[model samples]
Target chain A: MYVGFPHMGNAHIGIRGLFKALGILTIDLPPVNRLTVELGAKYSPECSCLPFKTVLGNYIQALEKGADCLIMLGGCGPCRFGYFGNLQEKILRDLGYDFKMIILEPLDWRQTLRQLQETFSPVSWKQLIYASRLAWGKTVAADTIESFSHFYRARQSRPGIITGIYQRGLEKIDKAYDLASLRTIVKEVEGEMKAAVLPFEPEIKIALIGDIYTLIEPYVNYQTDLKLGEKGVQVERSIYSSRWLKENFIPWEKKKKRRKMLRDAKGYLKNMVGGHGLDTIANAVRYSREGFDGIIQILPMTCMPEIVAESILPRVAEDYQIPIMSLAVDEHSSDTGLQTRLEAFIDLIAQRKKDKKDYFLSKVHEAS
Target chain B: MKTKIGIPRALAYYAYYPMWKTFFEELGCEIVLSPETNKEILDLGVKEAVNDACIPIKLFHGHVSSLQGKVDYIFLPRLISMNTERTVTFCPKFLGLPDMIAALDTDLPPLLDMRFDFKKGKKQGFKGFYEIGKQLKHSYWAIKKAFQNALHAQYEYEKLLAQRVTVQEALAYLYEGKELSKPVDYSLKFAVLGYPYAVHDRFLSVDIINQLRKMGVTPLTADMVSSKRLAAQAQKLPKDLFWTFSNQVIRAALYYLDEEKVDGIIHVTAFGCGPDAMVDKLIELEAKARGHVPFISISVDEHTGEAGVQTRLEAFVDMIKLRREQ
Candidate 1:
């Protein structure tokens, strides 16, 4: 049986590695493209968030490619993500797609394991442990590679080279079967990224904050992170899928970092508003305190949590003395518009940086 | 001087105002309610609230703004979960409504933001109220008596609702001792499903229920169905939906469709509501799969024109009538 799941940045690499170690043949669904967005928007509830539409599109594409089973994570929240599987299953079934859908809720691993055992060829405990470890390693490695690429992308003189290296590195990470090999592959990728960077370029750091899916998925955000990096801005994401998995699934994982974020957000937002709403606020504060240049919040149109964050963000921005630009994306969001916005924002920040430097130099001269 | 507590007549106020009013009044505090939603309030909400928030959230912000400086403390409960058996929560906006208000307008009256969650055991839930009582320096006995009275009022109000009285009618009868008016029955019964805030708020929903009455039709609502029945209907789904209100709305819609109780169902939804986006699809699919009960969804935002809503309602009622004639 061929397995399928939705794409969130390089998350598919980890999923592919996990299923492969279990001797499962996973279908490599094509990356999210215009056709995928079109198909997803066409069938999904008009007001549902972008992740639902794009993921539904992924499932449809996978089903058409002869995959008979799909697995999706479930959330428990005020977030609509928790119910995506239930509604998507009904929609797909209504549209006549005959595929078994498995929704794995967080903290219900035993049930998921039992279901997996029932559906596929039985795997020994040893193999299961090995598979999960490999999946975790690959996910972490992919995330590391992504961060390295983001750093190198801004400093590299040539356009598209880092993206190519990033893609090749992902391919290598996907093939590694154990932790040792995964580490080696990550180091190799890091070395290549280091070698590729040109002489020091003036760094204008921007925090990429918003809904996890929109922030991670390149196609959805028109590759805003990469675009900003290409335009010589260092972009750091607020959350990563691997980090999210570790925080939610691993019982031993200390959530001190997330707690700190909550504390930072306390002055602005009092509660966890579900999704990445609280994270956006906390990360913005963190970035501002660390002297980051600006913040770009990318969210799907009608996203509930981000909307709440967006409403409070202006205050956070004002109090912190940091520039913030919120971009609402939907199926109709054109890359040209996004690109223009990114360029304009970058220019504004760069000019602000220059003005600050000149003012500091003038102050020093006056003191002398 | 009597401590004045402001309760914005939006969101949970539509359902739990009587209980809250009873509790506060019993605690020797005067209650102040933001007026029934008007154009000015909606406009204020739209202006103050985040642009991406649904009309309900925006309206909620507007109500709080209207109460600024008028009351000593604004009551904005951070409603997390309503379910005891499982984890069902309010929309994230509800969880952060107090914070949103505090951030939007710093000069407003101090907010009584209490975290109300039934999922966190009975003791913890009571502690939320206990803390509120302590803040007001009320004795434990007084708080206990007030709590009991509030619960009784809420139970009675829900009973009145189940007895076929509209929320407004039930509230009026319970509070003012006004006689409950029997609603005029028409041949066509349409189950109007939505959160209480969206369905009962006259201005927000463009008085859809009264509009239906004018068209010679009976409007059935989620409130008329018992919570027990709604919960049972919800169990029919693969899993429980995350939000309490969404589950009720969906179950009410499902009950109508499965039991063949209504000729048609209309979902009055705030345009950008996260839960309704899913609930609406589920109900629509269920209605379509059943292939007998017709379903219509009316999306309302600040810009929702009354004429547009009326046109849609008339068309829907007309279509249902024609289908019946066949």
Candidate 2:
């Protein structure tokens, strides 16, 4: 059986590694591109969030490539994401596609495992453990390289150098056969990134937060993080795919960290509010308190949780004396428009910093 | 002088108002309801709410805005989930409704933001109410008595709804002790599905129910379907939807179509609603699969003109009437 999943940055690399480890044939899904969005929008509900459309497009591409089974993540929530897999299945079936949909619901791993075993060749306990380790190792290595590139992108002397290295590093990680090889690739990427970084401090630091899909998928968010980095701004995302997986599936340090996040969001937002709305609030407060220059929240247009966060974000900005902006993206979002917004935001932060320095200098002069 | 607690007449107002009204009234707090949707209220909601919010949330913001300065506090409950066994919840907007209202940057009375969840044990659910009562400085026994009375009021309201009474009719009966009126006979019945807030708000929906009535059609909404029946019908779907209202709308629409009880199905969706994006599609697909009942979805936004809604309703009613005659 050929299996497929949606694209989210470098997530496909790890999924492919897992499939390879499990001796399962995997379909190479076309990366989220113009055709993907177009096909998705053409078939999807006009008002469905952007992620659904893109993911559906990916599924269609995979199906066209002879994939018989698709894997999708699931949740139970006030957010619309939990129902995406089921709805997409109904839609794909209605559109005359014959395939199996495997939804990996959190905390319902036994059902998901049973479904997987039923659909694919049975795996022994040793193979399952090996597959999981390889998958996690590749994912963490990919996520680490991506974060490293973000750090070096702002300080690299030449444009696209860090990104080039990051891309090559990911390819190597994807090809690695075992955990030891994956670790070696990650360390090599880190060393290369360190060697390439110029001796320069970024002028502005911005925390990127919002809908997890838009936050992780560079295509969906129009590469806002890279764009800001190219403009000499340091960008720190509130969530990474590996971190999100760990938080959801791993129990260690989850409760304590979650408590602190909720504590930070006390006055602005009290409840979880589903999806990443509460996380956005908490991270905004955290980054502001940590003295980040600004916050940029990116979300799919009509995303329910982000809409709630967007409504309350102004208050967080005011209370923290920070500049916060939310960019809502959909199929209609243009790259140039996003670029202009990022450039303008960076300039505003720079101007604000200069103005503060000038004010402080004048005050010292008056005192003398 | 009694404390006046204002409740916006949107969202959960259509579902749980009687219980809330009884609880507050029993606590000796005077209940102040924001007036129904109006031109002025809609205008206010559109102005104050964030640009990205759906029309119902925007209209909710408008209702809250109107209640300002008239009451001691606005009672905006963050309704997380209604089901104990299932993992269903209210929409995200409903979960953070209090924060949205508080962020409007308008000066107003203090907000009595209450957390309403039944997912916790039954005892814990009432404990949340008891905590709210404590904030009001009510005695423990008074709070317990009020809680019992509120549950009873909610029970009776559901009973009235099970009898096929409209929310408006049920609310009127519960609040005023009015007798049930005679049911109007109709030639065609359409299962009109949507969140109660969007469907019941005459201004937002352009009073489509009454408009259908004028055309000799009766509109059967989710509220008229009993919870047990809704739960059972909802199981027909391969998986459960996350939101309570979305599930109800889907199940009610499915029930009507499967039982061959309705001539057609009309889905009233607020423009840019996150859940209805999935719910409407499911209902439409189900109707098409059945290939018997006619289905139409009417999308209402803040800018939805009365003429547009009327034209669509007229056309839909005419087409379905033709189908029925054939």
Candidate 3:
């Protein structure tokens, strides 16, 4: 059976590695673009969130490319992400596509294991363990490379140098057959990124927080990170695929970091509003305390959790004396508008820094 | 003299007000319910609520604001589940209602945020209610007796709904302690599916029930169906929906479609509601494919106008009537 899954940033690399290790043929969907958005919007309900539309578009494209089975994550509500699997299945069936869907629901490992067993029949349990380890390694490697690229992009003297390196790094990771090679390539890439010469120090550091889908997917959020990096601002994102997997799937590790974030968020949000809402508030506070110049919250339009986060964010921003820009994106979110706002926000951060410096100088002069 | 406990007339307030009111009153607390949703309340809610929250959540903010200075404590329960089923859960906003209210930067009274989840059977629910009673300085026996009375009142309120009375009429009867006879059905019966807040709120829904009646259409809501019937209908799907209210709405729609008793279906969803987006699509697809039932979806928000709703309702009814004759 040929397997396919929706594109979530660099997750397909890990997923593809897992399927290959299990001796399964896999087809990866084409990268998200305007065409994908349009296709998804056409078949999707008018009000369905942007991520759903894009992912549905991805599935349709993959199926058209001869994928017979699809794998997707499932959620159990308070958010719309949980229902995407069921809704997409109905839509595809209504459109007369013949395919199978495997939804990996949280806390339902038995069902997931059963589905896995059925799909890869005659495979040993040891092979399953090997596949999972390889997949997890790929996820960690991809996130690391991406994070390093963010640092390089902000500091590199030449524009597009870091992106070129990132692309090549991803290609090498994809071609690597085992954990050893994957680790070697990741280390080599990190060394290369760090060795690159820098002409100037980064001016401002901003924390990127919000809905995971929009924050990670460049095409969905108009490549906000690259744009910010181009403007000489260092972007530090709170959520990454590996971190998310660790927090959700790994039971013991879930409490330590996330609990601290939640505790930090307690003064502002006070509850889990679902879908990274608490994360947004917590990260905003954490970033502010870490001396970050600004915070950017990017979420899809009409996203419930982020909306709740957005409401409480202003107070957090006021209390912490940090400037925050909340961007609610959808199919209609204009690139030019985003760029304009982002530029203005960066300029505001620079102005604030200078003003603080000047005020300190004045105080020192008065004391002397 | 007793402490005044404020209750917002939005979200689950339409469904569980009787139980909450009876319980608090039994504990010697005076209930101060925010007035029915009005423009001022709606505006306040809009202003205070997050920009992307649905109309009902915003209205809840409005109701809370209306009672801000008038009461000692706001009773906003974190209702996670009304059903014992593992998959069933309330909306995320409902789960986070008390926290959201507390974050609103208003000088509000302290909140008596109780949690209600029937996952571990009625024992957990009892523990929650008992905790609330304890906070109010009530004895264990008094709390137990009050809990029994609250349950009985809630059961009676639900009975009125099962007998086909609209929530508005049932609530009126509840307040007046009078029996409300079910109204006689009109010629064309239309199933109106939506969340309690969207269907019952006069301002948000623009009184769609009365508008349909004026247009000579009898409107049946999800509340009119029994939980057992809804559960049975829900079982027909491959997997039960994980949301409590969405499950009820979808099951009610399924019942109407499967029974083929209603001429058409009108689904009212709050603008930007996550679960309704899925449920609405499912109902629309089912209604069209299986029974060829005429389905109209109306989205309500702060910006929705009365004339547009009325015009659509009239047009939908007229088309159904025409189709019936044809």
For A158-184, candidate 2 gives per-residue lDDT tens digits of 888898899899889988998888888
What is the C-alpha DockQ of each candidate?
A: 0.80, 0.88, 0.60
TM-score of 1: 0.96
Query: In model 2, what is the error at residue B115, expressed in angstroms?
Result: 2.0
| Alpha-carbon DockQ of candidate 2 | 0.88
Q: Tell me how far the alpha carbon of residue B220 in candidate 2 is from the true structure, in angstroms, after superposition.
A: 0.8
Best by lDDT: 2
* lDDT score at residue B11, model 3, on the 0-100 scale: 92
The true-versus-predicted C-alpha distance at residue A223 of model 1, in Å, is 0.9
Off by over 4 Å in 1: A177-179, A254-258
Give a tens-digit lDDT track for model 1, residues A1-368. Answer: 88889888889988998899999998998788998888999999999999999999999899999899999988777788888888899999999999888989875668877887789998899999999888988999999999988788989868888989999988888777789988998889888888888889647999899999998898999999888888888888988899888777666563775677789898888878888889888888888899889999999998888888888889888898899999999998998998888889998998998999999999999999
Model 1: per-residue Cα lDDT at residue A311: 87
lDDT of 1 at B190: 94
lDDT of 2 by residue, B63-168 (tens): 9999989999899888877677577888888888998888879997998888878887656678778989999998999999998898898888898888888888
lDDT of 3 by residue, B1-326 (tens): 78999998989988899999999999999999899999999999989888788888888899999998899999988987776888678776777777778777889888898988788887778888998888888999999999899999999989879988999999888797777765877999999999999999998999999998888888999999988888789667866786788888989998888874798999999998877878899999888787588999999988889999999998898888787799
lDDT of each: 0.87, 0.89, 0.87
Mark the regions of model 3 whose C-alpha exceeds 4 Å error after superposition.
A255-258, B177-182
Best by TM-score: 2
Please report how far candidate 3 places residue A177 from its true position, in Å: 1.2
Where does candidate 2 clash, by residue pair? none
